[model samples]
Structure formats: C-alpha cells, structure tokens
Target: MEFETKYITADIKLSEFKGNTFKTEVMFEHHILVWFISGETKIIQADGTYIFNAGDIFLIPRNQLATVINYPKDGLPHKAVAMHLTKQRLKDFYSRHKPAGRLQPLQKVYSFPKRPLLQSCLASLIPYFDLGKNLPAEIASIKIEEAISILRSIDKDVDGLLANFDEPGKINLTEFMERHFMFNMTLDRFGYLTGRSLATFRRDFKKAFNSTPQKWLTEKRLELAHYQIAEKKQKPVEVYIEAGFENLSHFSYAFKNHFGYSPNTLIGRQR
Candidate 1:
C-alpha cells in the first residue's frame, strides 16, 4: 500500500497509511512533533523501542536514526499529524528566551500521552487542515511557536533537546558501528554521524576492523541473520530487513553465500 500525506503547511502535514503495515527507516533532519489521531506507531531506535497508540503525542529529536512502523487500528487508517521544527525556526524561538544551565543532549523520544494541555494545543489545528490552500503560512508558524512554548512549559528539561544545536562530535568508531550497523544508511551518513570525512572513515575503519566497511557490514549483518533464524527461530523473511539487507532476495543469496546454507535450511534443521 502507498503512504499518503496532505500538507496543511509546508512544515505541518497529515499522514495516512491504509494497509497491513508500513515500515521505513529514516534519519530525521528536523525535530518532529507527532500527534497520533488514529493509529499505532512502533519506533525502533539504536538504544530502544517505543510504541505509541491513538491519542498519543511524541517528540522525535533531529539527526536520530530510527525505524518506524505504522499500523492501522480499529478499522481506521493509520493517521497522524507531524510538525517539523526546523533548526532555523528553533534558533529563532530560543534566541529571545534564554535556556538556563549547560546544555546536555540526550538521545530520547519524549512522549506526552493524555496531557490535556498538549492534546488541546494539537487539536486546535485540526480545523485549519480542511482549509487547504486558504490556510496562512503565518498561522502554521504561530502554531509551531505555541508548540515549542508548551513543550518547554510542560517539561523543563526539554530545553536541553530544543535549545542546544551541536553537531555530532568525534566518537569511538567501533562502538558506533557495532551499535548502528543494522541501519541501512549510506557510508557518507555513517561517516558524518561518526564525525569523520569519507576518506578518513575509510582509513580509520580499515585499521580498526582490517576489512572494508561494506565487507564488514555484510558479514556482521549475516551473522545477525544467522543467529536470528537458527537460534531465535525467526523466518528468513522476518529477519532480512532488520539484518540490514535491502531485500529478501539479496538477504537469502548472501545468507547462503556466507553460511553455506539458506536460512530456510537452517530452520529445517532446527525443526
């Protein structure tokens, strides 16, 4: 099934998916405020997994890698409204109101479920969605500002997330890769997140692992797939995508090549 999105503004949108389920991996460039109207969303990050049901609201910080799965609930399509809080916009908001104390960033998805204040704030915009072309850009901007304000008021520690704008610093490469290799991101994205240039990432990676990034990633992913199928008793179809392979065909071919047997063969032996 195809995903559909209707933009109330350039930054605010209503997204709908009418299907069994839709899953996608994404690295958000802007902080996202999502209000689930009628659906369930499962978000898997490097550190943890989160589930949000209908009437749930959450904040996803920018530059975080996550796999999101949206599922329809109660005979309705999975529907939600997402407001993107851009860097420039947040910078503008935080300039006038200073954030006290040193900024300490945390990788977390904040949830504010059943909060009357937040629910009211988000529900107020529902009417304007039907306005379509008639809705003014200033109105969307005003709503965004209101959201930022409400977020700070509701959670004082949110300033640490919204106010601070720092790029990814140099981190331990081996640790980063081992944690995030399941994500199918470009080498460039991996390099950027690890605070290295493409050339430097390549050089540093070779020294650390003694294998090229592509080769290492493939081997590591297949190992994970093998464990999941053989030990965890998961099917090849279920394990492939999470193992970092783009498609089942590729995953099956690679599984056979790497372990000298298809994943199904391993499953049959266990059975």
Candidate 2:
C-alpha cells in the first residue's frame, strides 16, 4: 500500500508497528483507509469499542477522534496500511456520478467503523504488502479503484463507496478545476475525471463550495486574469487568454463580475 498513483491524492504508505498496550491514543491528522493485515486491535471511538482482527478493513473519517487498543499475540507482529486522504481527494471522488444505494442513509452499529467487508480484502493483500513498496503507478491506481469497488460491494454500513460518486471530493477536484479552467472547463469534464454524472456533480459541488461550479470557475478565471495584469502587467486580451478564457467578450463579462470593473479599466489603472 506504499505507492503514488494518479488516482491517489495522497501517497499510500505501509507501516509495521510493534507495541504492547491495551490503550493507544493519537489524533487523526488526515482521513485514513485502514486495512489491518496482521494481529488484532480494539477500535475505540466516541461511540464505543469494536474488536478488530486480521482481515479487518475499516475507515477513519477525517477530523473525528478515535484510538486503537491492541489485542496482544505472542507470535505475530502488528502491521497495517494507512492511506492518507486529503480533502481534495474526497472532493474529486464526489465530482462525477452518484451510485444508487451506495451509502446507508441511516446510521447503525456504532461499534464498527464504516465498510466492514475490507477484512477479507486486507487479508488477501497480506502477500502484496511488499509489492506496495514498489508499485507501478498504473497498477497502483487500478488496485485502489478495485479496492473501492470491493468496499462498495461488501459494505453494509456507511455510504456505498460507489453509491454517491457524485459527492464532492477533497483533493483532485480543486486541482482539476484549477488546472483546466480555460479550454473546456465543463462540469461534464469534471464528472468524468472522478467517474461521476454531470448532473450529480453540479448538485454536490454547488452545495460544498456555495456556488455553481461554473460560476465559481468564471470567478477563478477572472481572478487569475487580474493577477496577471496587476502583477505581470499583461494586456487584457493576453491575460484573458492566458487564464484560459476562449472568448474576449465572455472573459470581459466574467472579469467585470469578479472585479467590479472592465478588464481594460483594471489594466489601465496598472499602466
């Protein structure tokens, strides 16, 4: 699980831990997909404790406090794969399509973390722990996607990993938008990047960011354009094109909306 893939907003890392304690406390600095490969642990959350063992697959949601209390075994070592997920990654995941019945609308079983089916998969991955250390980007990406698919199919609680594909993601969404605002910055493209539906993407992104994705995009373009003009002294048309606006008229309109002045006026003020 130690690899970097295009699909991964954060790199995957594998860790082998050796400690004997009933109670272990630590704050979650990032969202994590925890796959337990060996040994056992008592998962302690605000809700309660769940006994987790070899083959246990679970998720630790970001910003939620939790702890791990190890279940001791004399012969075996404790090992796990923890993939750190950035907010952008979550946003990217939800940018495309919503899967039907992917998530549980109602909460149940406070003792267990979301996505219990990962135990078997994590068990299956025991042999590949070392392969993760030298994973090819394409292979790593495929494995992660497959892992999510399995997680969706087997999970009974939490949101289906695939069910709400249209949900706004954390990392790749902003990166994608910020990267491709000019030529064809369409919602459809955004959805495709994360395997989602355009309609679903629009709904979730608007809620998460508090503006239509397109509107927000236009503003982004305008802001970038102004920065180039004010900071670099680029011409209005040049800045517009450089910022990815295809049409001068459209760029002017968006630039005005964002800055409360014509693009020309701003450039003039600078000159």
Candidate 3:
C-alpha cells in the first residue's frame, strides 16, 4: 500500500492512495476541506468516528490527532482533493474582509450535505491537480478564495470558524488530556495546546491528575494498550504505536512492568 500527494499550491494538495486498508496518524496543523472523489475514508478521533464516501465534502478542525483509514472502492485507487487553510491564509482573509465580531467555538468537524455550488467549485479544481507542482501559485490562491466564498454561502458558520483565528486559550487540563493522550507529541506541545507554560502545565497537571504528565501519560497509554491487546485481539506492535509509545521495546518493557507479563504472553493466552 502506498499514499502519494501532489501539491497544487503551498497549502492545497491533491492526495491519491493505492491501498486496500491502512492505518495512519494525522496531526492536523491547519483546517482541512476534503473533497472525496473515489474512495471511502474513515477518520477516528477522540470525539467520534466519521466516514466519507464519494462526492462527500467535509471540514476538519485543526489542532487534533486523528487516525485515518482509506479504502478504495470498485477495484480502483483512492483519490481525494484536500484544501489546507493555513493560519496565514486565514489571517490574510480576515484582514481583507474584516468581519465584525469574534466567533464562538465551532464544531470539531462539519460535513456538508450535497451542495451544487460547492461540488462545482471542487470539480473545477480537479483538472489542476494534473498540473502538479507546476500549477501557478496565483491560480491556486484564486481557487482557495472561491472555495471559501462558496462555503460561506452554504453555511454562515464557515466565516466564523475560518475568520476568527487565534491561538488556543487555556483549557481545562483534565478534559484536554483525556481527549489528547493518544497523540505522540512532546509535553511542550501539550502545554501550548492547553495555553499554559511548561511550568504551569506541570503544576496544573499534578493538581488535576495527581501525577506528573509523563507518569500519567505512560499509565494511560499502557492501559489502552492492554485493552487493545487483551480485549480487541490486536497485535502489541500496532497497539503500542496507536497508544502513543515511542517503540516496541519501550512498550514491551513498560507493559510487562505494569501488568507483570509480556504482551505476547497475553496474546498467547487469548489464542
């Protein structure tokens, strides 16, 4: 199985997949508008599972971890067009349009129902993917603008979600950690996302969870790995990665220390 992406512009990309089934992690740095053409895409996040089929268009919020599964349909390769709305692009648009007020926190993801205008806009951009990196940046920018306009027409919430760009504010530590522990990122990243300095994050973490961030994360991940291995019948290697361990050796060491047996031993007993 292989996945490839062609850039139409710095921020916009066209992705193609030649895979029957595969799992990968995604840390979304920018808000994404996905136009599915010929595949079924399943995204599993902390909140829920979302599936996108052919001719489906959806918006994914930035700053979250997601596990994505792509499957081809009808014996064909998977293909999709993804438009990434980077922070700079959003800031530029906000400066130009100057919307009146700030936006409330929007939904994590938005799936648009069939809309002719949105579909037409996506169709017009399909040909440009063939042009590959040679596609002029100016032309791609125009298409991005057009897409934003169409989305605004379809949903008033679009403008609010896209325009009011700001760094994440302080959030409750427990809630944030519970939703994000599966991500294999540094503590500093977690601190930034929670809008706390490293010192404050550590202090708040201890107060909230009664443990250091590292200790809490390790225990939580191991617990999840145990569930996947013992209950879901998944391999330890796969569970280790998905549960946010750095590698098999560390996971194995920790799993045995925590559970008094190796993961393979558990798998053997299950069999």
Candidate 4:
C-alpha cells in the first residue's frame, strides 16, 4: 500500500501505515518533534543512523534531508505523532523571550533521554489524537511553547538552537557537498543552502570538486548506491531512492554506465 498520513493540526500530524514496509527521503521544512508510538523507525542522516522504537521522542532540525524507513512490529501498523514547529512561531517566542546568546548549531537529530516531563507533554496531546480534533491555533502554539520549555529545562543549549532563526550561512563548498550529495534536490537549492548564488555556486563547486556540481553529485550517489547494494546487501529499489535517485530506471541506467554492469547483477549475486 502507498504511504498515508493525516494532519491533526496545522502543526501536528499523525502518520500510520500497514501491510508494507517503505522507504522515503524527507526534507524537513520546519523543526520537528516526533513521538514514536508503535512499531519502529530508522532515520539515516549524513552523520549516522538513528533507530526509534515505541515511546521514543526525538527532535529533527530543519533544512536537513534524511532517509526514513518504516516497518511493522508485532503484527501492528507503524505509527507516530509529528509536531512541526514553524519559523514564524519560533520567531515570536524568541522575540518575547530572547536567549542570552547564540549556541552552536544543533546536531541533525536530538534524541531526548527518557524523562517523565517529556512523556507527560506527549501524553497531553493524546486526547486530541483520539478525538481526531483539530487543535485551536492558540492551543497548538502553547503546546509548542511547552515542548520547547521542557527541552530547555533538560538542556540549556536548546534555547540557543531555537533562538537563532536565520538561513544557513556560507559554508565550505567541499565539506557541504560531501555531506549532502544524497539529497535529491535541484542545483539551485544546493546553491542557496550553501549560501551562494547559482553562478557563484557553480564557480566555487568547480574549484572545490574539480567537476561540475551535477557530475559530482551523480557520481557520489551512484557510488554510495553501489556500496549499499554490494556490501550492505540492500535491494536496488530501496538503495536507489536513498542514494538520491528520483526513480529506479534513472538509477539503474547511471549505475550500469558507471560500473559497466546492471545494478541487478550485484543484487542477484547477493541473493
């Protein structure tokens, strides 16, 4: 079955799926707090992989790409509650309660250690989910505030991460490319994320990688796909998407061209 999701509030959503395991690439537009209520979720980021089981709560920073896998456990559907924190809401909060100073950027994902306060905060939203009621905007905003407050109480550094609402700054082109090649986004987006104009991004990319951005990204993704299929024993269909290819045919064509063999050849050999 295809993946399905439901929105409980403008900012909060409930996602559920059953009878099939699936993988998808997600690019977060807002800061997200996820509560895994059942089954399991594996989130693979540039830095590492994170596995969330039932009752696990984690925060995902905005403007990042990740490969998410959802599968059933104990003959039940996979389920999770996701809260999206919008930039405008965060800005309003920051204006009223300004943090002392900027803190270093947060990690790709912050897995909060189990705490009663955090659990209670999540529990408070259960009724709305059960009733399928849309939370009033004001009430939802307060919930976000409460969640942020809890995070701050647990880790003061969270205040800094939430206070600074700015676009990504100019960063090392080489380093950025190395980390983000698996994201299937346009060159224009890459340019903006790296804090460079399209023309400047192309020039700097050529200087840093000795090739055009498209060429380098294609090669990088195919290389990673090969590794996942040949060494990690993953299926071509799954690896293709994770490696940033938009479709299987495109990934297969590029893989065969690069390696002088079909991707299925590797998968067939593995089986």
> What's the number of clashes in each of the models?
0, 27, 0, 0
Index of the highest-TM-score prediction:
1
lDDT of 4 by residue, 1-271 (tens): 6456766688888788885676777768898988888888888888998998888999888877788878888877898888887888888887888675347767669888687898788778877876666888788888889998787788777766677678878999888889989987778778888999999999999888899888899999999999998998888987887788878998999999999999999888776
What are the lDDT figures for the candidates, one per model? 0.88, 0.57, 0.83, 0.83
Per lDDT, the best of the predicted structures is 1
lDDT tens string, model 3, 1-271? 3889887776777788896666677767889998988888888777877988999999988877677778898877788888898888878877787554337647567899698888888788878777644568788788888888787777776777887567789999899899879777778788988999999999999999999888899899999999999889999976786787767899999999999999999999987
Instruction: Give the per-residue lDDT of model 1 (tens digit) for 1-271.
Output: 4588778787888888999877787889999999999979988888988999999999999887888878898998899989899989999998888985437856899998788888888889888777766358788888999999888888888889998889888899999999988888888888999999999999999999999999999999999889888788899988887777778999999989988988888988996
Query: Residue 133 of model 1: what lDDT?
Result: 67
Can you give the lDDT of residue 95 in candidate 4? 83
Q: Candidate 2 — worst ten consecutive residues by lDDT sum?
A: 1-10
Give model 3's TM-score versus the native structure. Answer: 0.80
- lDDT value, residue 201 of candidate 1: 94
Badly placed stretches (over 4 Å) of model 1 are 100-102
The residue-by-residue lDDT of candidate 2 on 60-119, one tens digit each, is: 654333455564455666666766544454445546534546353332222234454555
Q: Rank the candidates by lDDT, best first.
A: 1, 4, 3, 2
Candidate achieving higher TM-score, 1 or 3? 1
